[model samples]
Target chain A: MTAVMETAGLGKQYGKRWALHDCSLAIPEGKVVGLVGPNGAGKTTLLQLAAGLLTPTAGTIEVLGGHPGSGPEQLGRVGFVAQDTPAYSRMSVSQHLRMGALLNSHWDDELAFRRIEALDIDPRQRAGSLSGGQRAQLALTLAIAKRPEVLLLDEPVASLDPLARREFLQVLMEVVAEHGVSVVLSSHLVADLERVCDYLVVLVASHIQVADDVAELLATHHRISGPRRDSRSLPADQHVIEESHTDRQTTLLIRTEQPILDPAWTTRPVTLEDIVLAYMGQARDQERARKSGLGVLR
Target chain B: MMRFAWLQFRNQAAVVFGGLAVVAVILAITGPHLVHLYDTTVATCAAHGNCSTATSVFLKNDHTLQILFDALVVVVPGIIGVFWGAPLVARELESGTFRLVWTQSVTRTRWIVLKLGVVGLASIVAAGLLGLMVTWWSSPMDRANASMYTAFDQRDLVPLGYAAFAFVLGVLCGVLIRRTLPAMGTTLVAFVATRLLVNHFVLPKLIAPTQRSFALNGVTVQGFGQMNGGPFTLFPANPNIPNAWFYSTQFVDRAGHPLSTQVLTSACPLLESGPGPSAPAGGGVESAVPAPGAGSALHDCIAKLAATYHEVVAFQPASRYWSFQWCELAIYLGVAVVLAGTCIWWVRRRLS
Candidate 1:
C-alpha cells in the first residue's frame, strides 16, 4: 500500500525551542489514523508541517508522494482544518462555498451544498453569527469538498460540545467512506479518536511512542496482573510497554506477537485508550529524564 | 485570485471611491470660481501696480477649503496605510484565518501578490485622482509664487507615490509585527518619519543645487533697528531671483571670507529683525525704514563699511519643479518595490 503521509527525521523549531524532532513514520493511505498526544506533545506542529502551514527546520516531510507545499498542485492534494476551524466572519455561507469553488481545482460543490442544507445552515447567513458547532461544520464542509488526496485536521473537535463533536465525526466518516480519502486527525483525548480511528499513532513530548494498526495493537498488547515477579522474567518476545507494582503483586502491559502460554498470569486485551495512555506516561518520564540531564529510562 | 482579492477589498474600495467622488464634486463646483477670482484680483492688479490688497483677498477666498484639502493631501496616504494595509495581514494572523487560506490551492506567493496587486493598483488610482483634483484647483495660486516649496507635498503627482509607498510599508510592518494595532502605529510612525527625512535631508542632495553669487553693495538697504545688542540679518526677499530655494545667505569679506562674529556684531547696527520689541508690532515692512529719508543715511553708511564685504546665496532654480516631482515619485516607487518584495519573501519563507 502507498503511504499518504510520511516524515523522515522531521522537526520544527519556534524561536530556539524545537516543538517536534527526530520523527520518522509513514501513514498508509485509505485509513482514518488518529494522532493522540498531550497538550505540548508537538501534535499541532506535526500536522502543520504535513499541511504545509509550517516548514520544517530539520529533516523532511512528504504528503501524497511530493513535498508538502511544493506548489499549487501539491497544495491542492491536501486539506487542513486548523485548530479553531476559522472562517471569514464577514462572509455568508454561500460566499465560502464560492471561495472554495474559485480557489480549488477539484471542488465538489454538490457535496458541499448538500451537506450545508442538511446541516440546516442558511446560505445567506454570515459566518460571524453562526454558532460554534455550525462554524465547525462549515469549515469541515469546505475541507471535505476540496476532494483532497489526504486530509489533515488539528484538534478538529477540541472545542465542540459532545453532540457537535459526534456530528462532526459522523460527517467525517461519511465523507471518508464516500471519497476514500486518507485522514490524520490529532487530539489530546484518545476517546474522541477511538470511536472512528482504524489506525493509531501515539505521540508524546515531541516523540512518536507508537504507530500501529488499532486491531493489531489490540491483539498483541495485554495488561497482565498476577503474583509479584521481575519484569525480566517475561518471555523475550513480549516487550514491556509499561510496568507498575505494589507489594507482592505485579502488573504490566506487554506487547507480544506470540500467544501467552503461562497460566499463572491472567491476560486482558488492551483498549486503544489504555494503550495510548501507557505510551503517554512513558513519554512524560522520558521528558523528565532528559530535562534532568539523564539518559532515556529504557 | 484577482476575483478573490477584489472581493476582500470590495468594501474598502467602495468607501474610498465614494469619498473621492464627494471631494471631486466639491472641487469641481468651487474650482473655477477660485481661479477667476485669482486672475481678476491678483493677476490684474499686480500688472498695473502693487496689489497687496488683491493678494490678501485672493488668499482669503476659500480659507476653509484650503485647510481641509491641505490636511487631506498630507494625511490621506497615511490613513490608507493604516486602515487598508496594516489590517490586511494582521487581522488574518491575529484571528488565525491565514491557516484556512494558506492551506488552499493558492501558494502564499500568489495570495500576497494578488492582494497587493489589486489593492496596490487601487491605491495608486485613488491617490492619483485625488492628486489631479488638488493640483488643478491649486494651480492658479501655485503659479503666483516663484518657489514650489509652499505647497510641494500637498499637490501634484507625488501623492500617488506616497500612497503606494505607505500602503506597502504598512503591509511590511504587518507581516513583521503580526498584530493590527502595533502595525498601524508603526506604519504611521514610519511613513511620517520617512516623509520628513526625505523632505529635509534627502531632497537637497538628490540633485545638485545651484549657487548664486552676487555683490550686496548695489541693493537698497532697508534701515536696521537696534534691539538688545545681538545683531541679525534683516533683508527683503531678493527680487532678482524671487522664486529660488535659498539654502544660505551670509555676509562675507570682499575676498569671500566669512566675517567673524565679533567684528560683524560690533560694527553693524543691531536690528529688531521681525516685529521685535522696539519695532511697531504690525508696522509690517515699512517699519524697517520707518521714515523715508532715514533709509539713505543708513544705506550710505553701510555701503561705505560694507565695501569690504559681499553676500552670497545658495539656491535651487524654480525651473526644477516638475523634475523634483518626478524624481521624488521615482524614489518613493523604488523604495515601495523593495518593501513589497520583502513582504512577499517574508510571507513565503517566514510567516508561520
Candidate 2:
C-alpha cells in the first residue's frame, strides 16, 4: 500500500526538552493505525506534527505526499481531531455543520447531517452543553464529513467512558469500512486500539520502539517459558523483548520469524497488549541505563 | 471561508449595529432640537452677549445624552479591542479550536485573513458610523465651543482612527499573550498606552507648529510682588492666535532668545514687603526701603525688558483642523496595517 504519511528524522523541541526526537515512520494507506505511547511519550506531539499544527525543529514530514499544512489541498487531504476534540462551544450543532460546509471544499453535507441525525444530536443545541461523548461525536462527524483521505485523531476516546468509547469506535469502524480512508489515532491504552487498528507504532521516551502490522507482530513475537537460564544464553535468533526470572525458572517474551524447535522451551502466543508493554518497558530500561551510565562516566 | 468567518462574526456585528441603530434613532430625534437650541441660545447670544451662559444652557438641555455619547464613542473602541479583537484568536487558541479550523480545507493564512478582514472591516464600520453620528449631532456645539483643536480626539474623524489602531493593537496583543483574559488585559493596556503616547508625544509634532515672536510691552504680569520678585513676574507676550493649540509661551530677547530668570533677578530684586503691625503699641506705620539707585535701575531694566524681550509661541493653528485629522488618520491607518500584517504573520508562523 502507498504511504499516507511519511516522516524522516522528525524532531520537535519544546524549549529545552525534545518532545519527539529523531522519529521516523511511514504509515501505510487504507489501514487504521494505532500510535500507542505513554503520557509525555510524544504521542500528541507526533500527531500534531503530522497534522501540521506544529513545525518540526529538525527533519521533514509529509502527509498525503505534500508538506503538512502546505495549503488548502494538503489541508483538505488530511483530517485532524486534536487532543480533547475541540469544537466551538458557543456554536450550535447546525452552525458547526454550516461552518464545516463553508470551510471545506469536499464537505459532505448530507453525510454530516445524516450522521448528526443518526447520533441524535440536537441541531439547535450549543456544542458546549453537549456531553463529552456527544461533543466528541460531533467533532468526529465534522472531521469525517470532510471526506479526507487521511484522518489523524489524537486520543479521541481518552476522555470517554467505556460505552462511549465503544460507540465511538463503532462509528469510526463504520466510516473506515465505508470510505477505506487511512487513520492514525494515538492513545496510551492498547485495548482501545486493539479492536480497531490493523497497524501499530509503539513509542516510549521519545523513541518509536516498534512499528508493524498487528497480525505480523503477533505472529513474530512469543512468550517462552523454560528451565532457569540466563536471558543472555538464549540463541541469537530469539530476540528477547522482556525477561523475568524466579529462583526456579525463567520466562521471556521474544520475537523470532522462525518456528521454535527446542523441546525444553514452551512457547505461547502474545497479545497485542503484552507486545506493546514489553516494548515500552524495554525502551524505559534502555533510557534509564543510558542515563545512569552517563552519570557514572561524568 | 468568508462565509464561515461571517457566521462567527455575525453576532458581534448584530450587537454593534443593533445598538447603534437604537442610539441613532434617539440621536436623530433629539439632534434637531439640539441644533435649534444652539441657534436660539449660543448663536444669537454670540452677537448679543453672555454666550458663555448661553452655551452652558444649550449644553444643559441633553446633558445625559451628551455624556452617554461621549462615553460611548470612546468606550466603543475599547469594547471592540477588549471583547472582539482580543478574543478573536486568544479564545480559539485557549480552547484549542484553532486546531480544528486550521485542519479543515483552509490554509492558516486564509483562515487568519478571512477572520481579520471580515471582523476588522466590521469593527471599523461600526466605530465609523458611531463617530459619524456623534460628529453630526455635536457639530453645532463643537462650532460654539471652538473645540475642534481642543478635544479633537473626542469628536469627528479621529475616534475612528483611534478605533482602527486600537482594534489592530488588540489583535496583536491577543496573538502575543495567547490567553483570553490576559490578552484582554494586555490589549487594554497596549491600546490605552498607544493612544496616550500618540496624543501626548506624537500628534503635536506630526506637523511642525508655527511660532511667532511679539514684543512684551503688553505682557500680563500678576503675582505677589511689590516689584518683580514673585513667580509670574515675567509673563510671555500675549499670543493673538485664536483657537490655536499653544505649545509654549516664553519670554525671548531681541535676538529672539529667551530671557533667563537670572537676568530679571539681577536687574531688579525684591523690595522689603508691606507695612508693620497695626496694634496701638506696635503699629507705628511700615518701614521699608530700596537700595540706592534701585528705583531708577529697576525702571531702566523694566524698560529694557519691555523694549527687547519678545514672546514666542509655537502652536498648531486652528485652520489646520482637517489637515490634522487626515494626517492622524493616515498614521493610525498605517499603524493598523502594519500591526494587522504582523498579526497575520504571527497566526501563520508562531500560532502553534
Candidate 3:
C-alpha cells in the first residue's frame, strides 16, 4: 500500500531546542493513524510538519508523494485542522462555509451544509459564540468539505469535555468510514485514540518510540509478571519495553514475536494504553540515562 | 481568492467608505457656497483693490472645516495602514486561522498577493477619492492662501502614494511581527517616521531649485546691521515669487563669493552706526522702512553695495507644483512596490 505521509530523518528545531528530531515514519493510506505522546513530546511539531504549517529543519517530509504545501494541487489534497480549531470569530457559520467554498477548488457544499444541519448549529451564529464541541465540529466540517485525500488534526479534542470528545470521535469515525480518507491526529490522551485508531505511532521526548499496526503491536507486546528477577536475564528476542520489581514479584512489558515459554511468569494481554505508557516510560528512562551520562562526561 | 479577500475586507471597507460618504455629503452641501463666496470676494477683489481683505475673508469662511479636512487627508492613510493593512495578515496568524485558509487549494504566494492587491487597491482608491474631494472643496482656500507648498502633504496625488506606501509598510510589519495589536502599533510608528523622513530630508533634493539674482538696491535690501560690535551684515528681502518654495537668499559679490563685512564698512562709513532702524536686536528685519533722516544715507549705502554685490535667491517656482507632486508620488509608489515584494517574499519563505 502506498504511504499517505512519509518522513525520513525529519527534524525541527527552534532556537537552541529541538522540537522533533531524527523522526522517520511511513503512514499507510486509509488508516486512522494515532500520534500519541505525552505533553511536549513533539506530536504537534510532527503533525504540523506534515501539514506544511511548519518546515523541517533537517531531513525531508512528503505527504501523498508531494511536498506539503508546495503548490495548489498539493495543498488541495491535504486538510489540516489546527490545535485550537480556529475559525474567524466574527464570521457567521454560513460565512465560514462560504469561505471554504471560495478558497477550495473541490469544496463539497452539500456535505458542509449537511454536517452543519445535523449538528444543529445555527448557520447565522458567529463562530466565537459556539461551544467548544460545536467549534471543533465546525472546523472538522470545513476541513472535510474541501474533499481532501488526507486529514491532519492537531489535538482537536484536547480541550473538549469527555462527552464532546466522544461525540467528536464518533463523527470522525463516521467521516473516515464514509470517505475512507487517511487520518493522522495527535493527542496526549491514548484513550481518545483507542476507539478509532487502527495505526499507532508512539512519540516521546522528540523521537518515535514505536509505530505499527495496532493489532500487530497488541499481538507482539505482552505484560508478564513473575518472581523477582533481573530484566538483564531475559532472552534477547524478547525486548523489555518497561520493567518493575517488588521484593517478591517482577512485571515486564515486552515486545516479542515468540510466546513466553517460561511457565513461572503470568502473561496477560496488554491494552493500547499499556503499550503506549510502556514505550513512554522506556523513552523517558533512556533520555534520563543519556542526560546523566552527559553529566558524568562533563 | 479575490472573493475571499473581499469577503474578509468588506466590513472594514464599509466602515471607511461610509465615513467618506458622510464627509462627501457635507462637502457637497457646503462646497458650492464656499466656491460662490470665493468668486464674489477674492476673485473680483483685484478690481476693487481690496484683495488682502477679500482673500482673508475667503480663507476664514470655513476655518474649522479646513482644519478638519486637511487633518482627515493626512490621517486617513495611516488609519488605513493601522486598521486595514496591519491586521490583514496579523489577525490570521494571531488567531491561527491562516492554517485554515492557507491549506486550501491556494498557494501562500497567491494568498498574500490577492490579499495585498485587493486591500491595497481599495486603500489607494479611498485616498484618491479623498484627495480629489478635498482638493476640490479646498480650492478656494488654497488660492486665497497662495502657499501651495505649505499644504503639499495634505494635497493631491501624494496622499494616494502615501496610502499605498503606508498600506504595504503595514503589511510588511504584520508579516514580520505576526501579531495584530503590536503590528498595528509598529506600522503606525514606522509610517509616521517614514513620512517625516521623506518630507524633511527627501523632498528638498527631488529637483534642483531655480536661482535668481537681484541687485542690492534700497528696495531689495530689507535691512542691515552690526551685532554687538561684530561685522556688518545685510539682509535681503524674499524674492517676489508667489507660492514658491524658497531655499535661501544670499548676499554675493560679482565673483559669486559671499560679501564680507570688511568690504561693507569700508565702502560705506555710515554702516558704523550701531544698527539700522529696521533691524531687530538679533539682526532680523522688523520693518523695511529706514530710520528718519537716514533714508538718503541708506540709499547711498545700498547703491554702493549694488555696484559690487547682488542678492542670489534659490527657490522652487509655483509652476513646478505638479512636477513635485508627481515626483513624490512616484517615489512613494516605488518604495511601496519594493516593500510589497519584500512582504511577499517574507510570507512565502520566512513566515513558517
Candidate maximizing lDDT: 3
**Per-residue lDDT of A1-298 in model 3, one digit per residue for the tens?**
8899999999999998999999999999999999999999999999888888788999999999999988888988998988989999999999999999998989999999999999999999999999999999999999999999999999999999999999999999999999989999999999999989999999999999999999999999999999999999998899999999999999999999998999998999999999999999999999999999999999
Return the top candidate by TM-score.
3
Tens-place lDDT per residue, model 2, B269-342, is 54222222111112222322334554444445556677667667888888898899898888998999999999
Model 1 docking grade: high
Candidate 2 positional error at B163, Å: 1.3
Query: What Cα-based lDDT does every candidate model obtain?
Result: 0.84, 0.84, 0.91
Q: Which run of 10 residues does model 2 chain B get worst, by summed lDDT?
A: B272-281
What TM-score does candidate 2 reach?
A: 0.91
DockQ of each: 0.82, 0.83, 0.84
Estimate TM-scores for all models: 0.93, 0.91, 0.95
Error of 2 at A102 (Å): 0.6
Task: Name the better of 1 and 2 by TM-score.
Answer: 1
Task: Compose the digit string of candidate 3's lDDT tens values, residues B240-261.
Answer: 7889999998899888999887
- Evaluated at residue A174, the lDDT of candidate 1 is 88
DockQ, prediction 1: 0.82
* Interface root mean square deviation per prediction: 0.8, 0.8, 0.9
Q: Rank the candidates by TM-score, best first.
A: 3, 1, 2
Model 1 chain B: weakest 10-residue lDDT segment is B271-280
